[model samples]
Target: MTIPKSVFVVDLNYVVTLPEIDAHIPGHVEFLDQCYEAGLFLASGAKIPRTGGVIIASAPSRESLEAHLAQDPFHINGVAEYKITEFQAKKHKPNFFD
Candidate 1:
């Protein structure tokens, strides 16, 4: 069997008005683009009812992930709070990590 890899599920909850969150979307997306380019993020999208967002990511350690997330515009602006959960991916698509 292969060893499982650590993955993080980041849940973002809006703490401010929708307009406030919207104002940061461009910067937030730019951040996401950078993460994706760095192969740190797997997937991300906004939640239904437009509450907040979620991101699936992988990193060497939780500390590293936290550091990266700290750069997010929402985090910087205090418009959203993040709750991150880490889990081991014991089973996933054949090329999920490729």
Candidate 2:
């Protein structure tokens, strides 16, 4: 089946030190779980340099995506800033489109 929603790449850049990020990890993880359950997030993980993280998601519109991202604990506590990029998925492995 084809999904009509737009794909987004959420880049989280940490503004504070590692301790602050650590302090909010629990809430941040909870937020991620909520996003997953809501079908907003497809995948996510920390950066190799430990600076921040990235999230692959989909939304009906940019406005809606920003609204949902605003609810993240990292955003709430100003621990990180988000840069959202929208893109088209032109290719994938077998069954990826299902």
Candidate 3:
């Protein structure tokens, strides 16, 4: 089965130092959890080897997603910066589901 095709996409770059990734973990978890509970975040994590983070979610529009993203702890607490782009996607196997 294919996953639904409405998601908020974030390309992330860290601004905070290594020390802060550790310090920011708790707040990040809390805010991210809030996002999850609100049905905002679907899949999220670092883009392998810790170069950056990516968040996939559902939102009605770019503006709506941006507003939600603006409240994320990483953004609010200055741990990372992000660029948001809205997407309607269906990924095939290897990329996701076939």
lDDT at residue 17 of model 2 (Cα atoms):
100
Task: Evaluate residue 32 in candidate 3 and report its C-alpha lDDT on the 0 to 100 scale.
Answer: 88
lDDT of 2 by residue, 5-93 (tens): 58889999999999989999999999999988988888899998999999998889999999999999999999999999998877655
| RMSD of every prediction | 1.4, 1.4, 3.6
Q: Give every collision pair in model 1.
A: none
TM-score of 1: 0.94
Better of 1 and 2 by lDDT: 1
Whole-model lDDT values for every prediction: 0.92, 0.89, 0.76
Question: Model 2, stretches more than 4 Å misplaced?
Answer: 95-98
Best by lDDT: 1
Worst 10 residues of 3 by lDDT: 89-98
Name the runs in model 1 displaced over 4 angstroms.
Answer: 1-4
Compute the lDDT for candidate 2.
Answer: 0.89
Can you write out model 3's per-residue Cα lDDT over 1-98, one digit (the tens) per residue?
Answer: 64545566798888867678778778888888998888777788887767669988777667788888788777888778898777667553453522
TM-score per candidate, chains pooled: 0.94, 0.92, 0.77
Worst 10 residues of 2 by lDDT: 89-98
lDDT for 72 (candidate 2): 92
